[model samples]
Target: MKVFVLGTGGWGIALAMLLHHNGHAVTSWTFFQEECDLLHRERANEKLLPGVRIPEGITVTTDMSGAAEADLVVMAVPSFAVASTAEQLSRIVPAGTVIVNVGKGLDSQHGYCRFSETIDRAMGGRNPVVALTGPTHAEEVARGVPTAIVAASASRAAAELTQAAFMNDTFFRVYTSSDLVGCELGGAFKNIIALGAGISDGLGLGDNSKAAFMTRGLTEIARLGVTLGAKQETFAGLSGVGDLIVTCCSMHSRNRRAGILIGQGKTAQEAMQEVGATVEGYYATEAGYRLAQQQGVSMPITEAMYEVLYNGLSAKEAIRMLLGRPRRGEHEEVWFH
Candidate 1:
């Protein structure tokens, strides 16, 4: 199988390497001329997946038309850039080609999962889109660590095909799911929970406090997600619980690191600049807060995070505001079936 990864960022480079390592012919396309030149001439992607050597036979190109003939195309760009990237690719990729996305989040202005229905709308004339998501991180993946992810498509056959093509014996695992909404919602909402957990960590709270925060944060996430047509069971899976635990606790989590700085009395701008990466949580937290308000769900963590991030409430004040909320039954069982 010939695969082309649309972005040459960390995830895209990692996936390209994984696909090639699985004995598939792989090529990575980069929009940046320097990255393409570096891969072609220096056999490196120093600007993106730096220090990783590209194996032989993997091509890198800046020509969109050059990669259009691939058997499968994977998108690993950030959510904020997905729409324009999708639009550009839609113009070049042939109809019926397998389109897959790994970005997670809802659009703030529109409030739908990234690539929710908009992907199909943007595809000039393409087949159904597929979503790939899980707890996997790019750095771990670059080192060939074992990881499992779900591939969701309206067409089960498409999902299965992606599973066959992407999954490997030891390093990479892919499962099939018809529940696209669940997969999409799980991928996005877990980041918000990670933000809350990071704040706890910054406040010098121990694992006990962080664990409790994670559980309650998830309750709010599930509430908002279920009200908007996601499955409750999906909350127990990799994109949900598994991803939350890893992101909320790990130093590798840029989102959590950013939040910790905020909690330690740094301004949001200072924290973000210090983190120096795409901390998806800061943006996702706002979208989640808006979504919670729209759904009329009481997301205290989400509200506190929004206040700290957007409304100019100091992080300490936000924490105090949350503690001041009237306590209620901790186990209300908000099942929406």
Candidate 2:
């Protein structure tokens, strides 16, 4: 299979490497001419994944038309860049082209899943939109570590098609699902919990706090996800629990780093600047807050995260606020009650 990946970020380069290693011919496109030049000239993305050279078999281009014509086009662009990138590719996406979304976050400006409804709108509602997400980090994935992900689409056939396109023996595994919305919600909401976990780390809170926050934060995820019509079990799968575990515990999670900074007394804005990369959690917590209210869901952890990210509440204050609130049975709303 011939695969084309859009964007020049770490994720984009990583996917290109992974797919090429899987015996597929891959062409990676970037809007930035400089990055393409770097790939061709140095075989490396010096800015994003320094010291890890891009493999020789992978081709890099700045031409959007060339990428859009492949057997499939993977959108590895950032959340904010997905819509515009999709629109740019819209002029060229072949009918029935499988558009896979690897970006995770809520579209803050328009309040939609990253490339979810937007890609559908961009393609005139013709192409299949698949989401490839899980707890796998790009850096580790690029290094050929064992990683499994859920590929979700409205069409099970499409999901399976993408799964086949991505599977390889060395370190990558793919699972297929037809629950597009649930898979997407699982991917989106886990970042917020990662942020809270980072805060706990920064505050010098013990493992108890981190464990409790992540566990409870997932409840908030399922409650809101169910209210929005997502499958309840989706939140317990790779895109949800799996992603949450790696992100909250790993140093590679920039979202968690951002949260830790905020917990250590830095403002949200400062933490973002210091992280110096796209930390998806800051925007997502805000989106989750609004989505919860709109869906009539009770999400205390999400609300507190919103207060910290948007309302300028300190991490200590947020912790105190949560502790001060009334308590309830753990399985009150969850199943198995």
Candidate 3:
């Protein structure tokens, strides 16, 4: 496969390496000419994935035209950049080229449009959009650590093509799904819960507290996801519970790290500055909160996270408020009869 990855961020570079290693002719693009020159000269993205060598087979470039004719074009930009990148790709890539989006946040500026919808709108519905997401992190994937991810699309052919392009027996595994909505929601909303889990860690809370936080957090995610037309079972799959577990516990999760900083007395903006990366959870929190409100779903954890992120509420106070809610059956509203 001739694969072009749009965006040279950590995730983008990692996928470039993965595809190149998988025997595909891979080319990756960066936004700036300087970044293109740096990666081409150094052969490594030291700032993002230190010590990982770029394969000799992968081509690094600054021009979108370099990827215009590839068999698969992976959109690995941050969520905020999805629409613009799609718009850019629409002019370059031909109408039938498959675009696989690895971004996981809702479009906060456009009624929280899913990445696929953003791509569809931006590309004028010319391409098939497949969403590839799960618990796999760039850090681990770059190191060839064992990981599994899901490839979801309304088109079965697109999903299988993505699976065939990236799946490897040793370190990478891929599954297919038709529920792009569920997969996108699962991947996006987990970051909010991971932030709350980090707050728990920063408060010196034990594993018990973190466990409760994650489980209940999934409930909040599922509630809103179902309201928005996602399959409930998707929340129990790799992009859901699997992604949630890793984000909450892994040292590599920017959202959790940012939350820890906020829990330790830094404001949301301050934490993000210190993290020095795009913390998708910060933006997702606001988007998810608004979506829940618009859909008449109760997402208490998301509400708490929104307060912490925007309303200047302390983490301790947020936790207190969360626990202070009236008791209800644990299974209430979880299972649809």
Candidate 4:
């Protein structure tokens, strides 16, 4: 298979290595000439996925034309860059090429459209789009650590093809799903909750509070997901609760780290600058809040996060505001059929 990956960030580099190892002809893209030159010369993406050597077979470049004849094009850029990358790919990629997005987050610029929809719209539906997401982290995956993820698409064939191309027995596992909406939502919303969890950790809150926060956060995620036409059951799978638990608890989570800084007397700006990485949760918090409002879904946790991240509301005040909300039934099933 000829696979071209856009974005030479950690996730992109990691997947490019995986594909190269799997005997595919792989090419990867970087936005800047300096980064592209460094990858080609050094055969390593030291800035992001350090210690993992880029395979000699992989070609890294800054040219979008590298995607023209590829059988598959993977969009591994940050969520914010998905639209632009998709637009670029649409112009270069061959007709009927499968494009899989491993980027996780809602498209804030497009009314929180999932990556599948965003990519499809960007390409005018000329290509099939699949979203691959789960608890997998680039740092771990780059080192060949064991990880499992789902490939979701409205087109089941596209999902199955992605599954075949990426799955490996020892270190990587791929599951297929038709619930693209659920998978994308799960991947995006958990980041917001992860930020909240990080704030809890920074505030000296113990396991009990964080655990409760995670549980309710899952509920809020499911509610919003269902409201947006996702299967409620998908929230229990790898992309939802699984991803949430890992992101909220793991040290590898940039979102959680940023949230911790914010909780510990740092402004959001200060926290973000300190992290020095793309905190998808920070962006997700705002997009999720607006989506909640537009959809009329009650996402208190997401709302609280939005306040803390954007509206000058302190984390403590947001917590207090949430605790003061009127009580409701704990088990109202929100099934999306």
> Pick by lDDT: which candidate is best?
3
lDDT by residue for model 3 over 85-195, one digit each (tens)? 888888898887889999889998789989999999888888899999999889889999999999999989999999999998889999999999999999999999998
Q: What lDDT is reached at residue 178 by model 3?
A: 96
User: In candidate 1, what are the lDDT values of residues 111-225, reduced to their tens digit?
Assistant: 5555756577678646668888888887788888889999987888879989998899988989888878878877887887787677778889788878878898887888877
lDDT (C-alpha, whole model) for all candidates: 0.81, 0.87, 0.92, 0.90
Using Cα atoms with residue i matched to residue i, what is each candidate's TM-score against the true structure? 0.93, 0.96, 0.97, 0.96
Candidate 4: stretches off by over 4 Å: 333-337
- Those runs of model 3 whose alpha carbons end farther than 4 Å from true positions after fitting are 333-337
Model 3 clashing residue pairs (backbone): none
Model 1 error, position 98 (Å):
1.5
* RMSD in Å for model 4: 2.6
lDDT for position 87 in model 1: 82
Clashing pairs in 2: 135-243
* lDDT per residue (tens digit) for residues 170-265 in model 4: 799999999999999999989999999999999998999899899999998899899889999999999999999899999889999998998898
Best by TM-score: 3
